[model samples]
Target: MELSPRGVNMKRAFIVPAIMVLFFSGCGKDKNEGGKTSPPQAKSESAAKSGGEKAQMPSRLQQAVKEGRISEEQARQIMARRAGGGDKPLVRLGTAARGEIRTHLVLNGTVEPERSVDVYARLSAYVQEVVREEGNRVREKDILARLDDTEIRISHQQAKIQLEQARLTLEEEKNNHQRNQELKENELISDMDFQASEARYRQSRLEFENKTENFKNLELQLNYTRIRAPVSGFVTQRLIEVGDRVTANQHVYTVEDFSPLLIRVFVPAADINKLQAGMNAEISSDTLPGRTFTGHIKLINPRIDVQSGTVKVTIEVNDSSLTLKPGMFVEVNIVTRSREDALVIPRTAVLYQRDQVLVFRFREGKAVAAPVSVGVTEDDRVEIVEGLEEGDTIIIQGAEMLKDGVEVSVLK
Candidate 1:
């Protein structure tokens, strides 16, 4: 039956007062009975004791238990759940999908250029001008530095003059020889005189040839006084400055060709058979972070080093931008094997137990440690040969603490 607001308020006030009086009287009776009391009194005593215990509880929890909203055990369970969170373990998941995967044999090597040449002075002279310094790009026969060629130039000019004089004398001897031949043919001059003229002509010819060669040599020497690049590349080192004396065949500069950089690596003999020319490779440098370059195997030595038991492999990188420099430390990953449509998953998700390989497969909010046949294990990724299909979700991170059938909460 519905009651008016005024009647409801008046009834609540009377009931509250009666409840307080009954509680007080029950408490007083419990105190008076002391060790002995009737069944009803004993029940009142028990109620009073339980009420005191309930007062120590939180207000909301006391109200809930008193109103029969929740049992004591259920309340404790809720508080424990709130205190320690839920019992489900948190995990990161990844899907098994078909993708390209490759296995690499990693090796460390030093970056080298296609060619490196040491520019040397072909003639002894002092450096007169430094046209190109270190880090200067140059081409074949480009003048790098001009040596002091003043003395060589003067000598060359003198040789030229001598060569011209010799040529004139040779012409004169040739005419005399022709005249002598005619005279001998006509019997106008004696044989001895003709023979002597012929001899002189021959001597003049020899002298002319010798002078010609001497002039050519001087010209070559003059050209050598100018240091030039032997190949087209960058000047990586300059050992001479202006006014510095350099001897013939002395190293003056070092030039390197940066196009199609090369790297030589030594692989153990056991793995050498896996390598071949024209295989793809990945190149990276510690100095240039986050940058990757593509390359291919240029050469592979068939013979293995007896002492080191390793084979030398050459990697060629076509880095047109020249981002990688010679002598920089680099790492090379030779892709010896690959697959186009393989079941791939994170390598971290795989667990190795004894002779079996397992992965935590997430299904129905539970982790199932299932054994899988693993194929190629590459960097951070592994190829599953069997036991897992496409679109299957597996625990990637936080799988180390997982057991069979353990519930988990997948993190987004």
Candidate 2:
């Protein structure tokens, strides 16, 4: 308790320094704790803000729904998987099934009548009467037109008169020759007279034959004045009219048979080998929408066109309705290859990377890349020859965004 001034001063200084040091140390600890705690609070606020933004932003499925491109049910299913917030990727799946696949060779073609005939005038004369006009249905031997037969009729009559006269002369010569033969046998006629009589009979018989031939020729010419249909068909064109002067062998009418229509197509040389006579084909035209005509290959040209690098093919269509007309442009689809009971998958599931053909198959909720051998492709399905089995599920849509072993949530 009794101390000197120097000692009091020294004690005071030590106590003040210790108190200040304790105060500063407490403040530093409080600052450090606040720093540590405030950061977590700030991080929590930032995380909450980020989550709110993500919820407000539209997902791929939501966007599709807004665009009217997808149904609400489909969009809902897609969004449901995304809302789960997992590592799984959303994908559309299709099942590999047994089906039929057919490959076709498509080409442009033209329609024509199966049978066409050009009727011609057989006699040189004026057209006296036209019984049938264009678009008239005619049968075989049906008279389509008639020619003026005045000159031909007169010639025929003259031939008949000459033939009758020759017949009478032949008969008289035969009777004379018979009497002469009797006289000669009784030694009442000379040998010269008998020879003359025989010569007269032979000449008369030859004359008769010549006249008969002339009469037949004239009769044929007279028949030719009447124009007849060579075939049973509809008259497509008529170039002759009543009182029109026509010459022999001139085209008078054009007749066509349209019961079975013909379609001609030029096929590329590369696909010609796949075609044959009697192969089934489907034909369609833009002019006649929603109509499909069934036909079969009728002919195949053995020679290939060097300039166009194509081969001519003829197809016959049964057009009983007569809806198809000649010169109509049409499209033809010929089945080149076909397979039944084939393991098939959607064409969209196939992926081409470099030289490999791969498909993303679903196995245990993961996408597994499988290399597949492809065969005939028909419509939206492709024949899987290898690396896939029936009933296996494969990714159809959203396959391009997937890789092997990635988790996938399949949408029905």
Candidate 3:
């Protein structure tokens, strides 16, 4: 029913239809804009092409990548970076800031590769030829030696002849069996004759299989005539030479990677925990005094040296000088603990009164005698590890005159 327009109830029917039409039309728009509304993210573009779910990044990130402002990998790296608790970063104060407490173990160490192998013989024969000597550089799969292959060659030839003979015999037996069957069907040959021919054919097939297997065995044996280096390295030892008779599974040479020699230093159980794989290390040897080789911890042994109460921490060094030799004694320095924006003051600012620790904090351009907490100590600085903050000037050159409310000026 229709009512007068002046009444509020008169417009109800028109408002209801208008809202319903708009809602249904919006639904259609959303449904039709699936792929257009959600463009794939950089990482997911390839995935999307392979029929995977599409991902969308904010328009800013997409634009940044498209406009060459940032690479896709850089964007991914930024996204992967931890928020660091979304807290303010601490800036360094002086050239010598945060006392990087280095828990260095200046003890004995050795050098070796994280990966090494020993050359071993896999077949039994005399060393017919040797191409590489000790301390010589060898490439992987290079022929190190060759065994006396005469026996193997002879065996291979014998196998080939036997196989050929077996083939001919099998063929002859097949023809004999076929002929016997034809003759018996025509009543010219007895059943006994046909059975004998079938038996011969079966026997020949068995002999052929045996010869084929022997031939394959001989082929495999022939392949073992030459001994090749399993890996590229410097041969450290040579155990066999030409005319030397060696058995299978014998160690013939010891090779090692010397490009970046690996050295291991036994770290105390207590100190080992301070280091991890890939931690930077500075190593030195008495053989190379005043020279420090930079490297990183390659491995840390799980088992502790029970006798020494230490664990063997392996180190790989890029000491291109060939200075850090395996079995050479070495001293190591490893950075263990570090902190950012740590409060620090001059070492001379603190006085150790026997068992007590004291420091003079500056306030209002004057010194205020303040007892302070301390941490790691370095060559010229002591970490306040507790007290000061950014821009808190301290007396570096004069600390003995520092006292409560004593006015002072920062040195220019």
Candidate 4:
């Protein structure tokens, strides 16, 4: 414990050198084990050892370091910031370009037949035969049903007898009037009797005309006993059966023309001006999956619906195959406006935050939040009216998790 000053200096010098040697030796070991190997190199070595494959740079920092844009220490610090939730989230990217953007007005509607008619009985009769049933296709003037015509036949026969009897009486009266006229010219009969004969002839002629008209009406009733289709179509409803006594004007069948099915949609009044007759339309149904039907605007109602504030639009779709049925619900898409070569981006890329709409645009390896004014939207694309130019890449798929000035990796 009792040492001189020289002895103290000698002990201090030896201890300092020894400590410096130990520190250098530990630094050499650290360089060999971890410090000299970069994160990408270490990842590659680990990947090769585990699966014998090249490792991929997982972050923007590692990629920057590998590309010599940033030092290893900087990359480590960047990754630390990212892990601590101080950096922006990773997102998938897309490019803004010039493309077509269409504006569509979507409306819900019901499918119906383009033309429909209800067949009714023209005369009271008993249904004796049913020739057509529901879902049966028929042509114009095709017999659909038969009614009992026995009473009509009897009435027709009676009318014919009366007509014949009146004709005979008319002939007899004419002959008598002619004979009376001849006698009156020769003064063989009085002028009064001649006038009486002339009056009887006229009355008989009128009776004959009345009888003939009655006979013709009876004939028409006989024809009506056979109910016929007024137009070519499918029978949607059949109300008559055998032995059913139907009165005149009673509904017997309902025929619907399905060659071109009609879709009735109510569009908002604001969009009514853009719609016109013969505009192309697309229709889809929940009942039919993955199938879209093409159609055109058939008619646009001039009157607006007072209750709904919408205009009635009729679209006609070809259904020659009879795949679409009446009363089926469908979705209709009407193209209101379309622009070619408009600046556009994926609709999913547009983000609405508060009152401002923005998109995360990728520029210089970072996500740059840019405000955008949108116009028309078609399908999965939207028209960018302002704040973006062509060839600019924007984050689309993972933009919801991204913020401004975040490092991004473009996925191939």
Against the correct fold, how does model 1 do in TM-score? 0.73
Tell me the TM-score of model 4.
0.71
Could you tell me the TM-score of candidate 3?
Answer: 0.58
Q: In candidate 3, residue 290 scores what lDDT?
A: 85
List candidate 3 segments past 4 Å from native.
Answer: 1-107, 122-126, 171-191, 247-250, 257-261, 288-295, 303-305, 316-325, 345-350, 359-370, 387-412
Q: After superposition, how far is residue 243 of candidate 4 from its true place, in Å?
A: 2.3
Q: lDDT tens digits, residues 135-223, model 4? A: 99999999999999999999999999999999999999999998998899899999888888999999999999999999999999999
Check candidate 2 and list the clashing pairs. Answer: none
CA lDDT of each prediction against the hidden true structure: 0.87, 0.88, 0.71, 0.86
Best by TM-score: 2
Better of 2 and 4 by lDDT: 2
Q: Rank the candidates by lDDT, best first.
A: 2, 1, 4, 3
Q: For residue 408, what is the lDDT in candidate 2?
A: 81
Q: Please, what are the lDDT tens digits per residue for candidate 1 over residues 1-412?
A: 9999999999999999999999998777533346654568678777866765564556766666676645676555544444455777666788999999987899999998899898888988889999998899899999999999999999999999999999999999999999888889999999889889989999999999999999999999999987889999999999998889989889889999898788999999999888889998999988999999999999998899999999999999988787888889999988889899999998878988899989999999999998999998777889999989999999986586689999887654
- Worst ten-residue run, lDDT, model 3? 86-95
Q: Could you give candidate 3's per-residue lDDT for residues 136-181 as a string of tens digits?
A: 8888888877888898999899999999999999999999988888
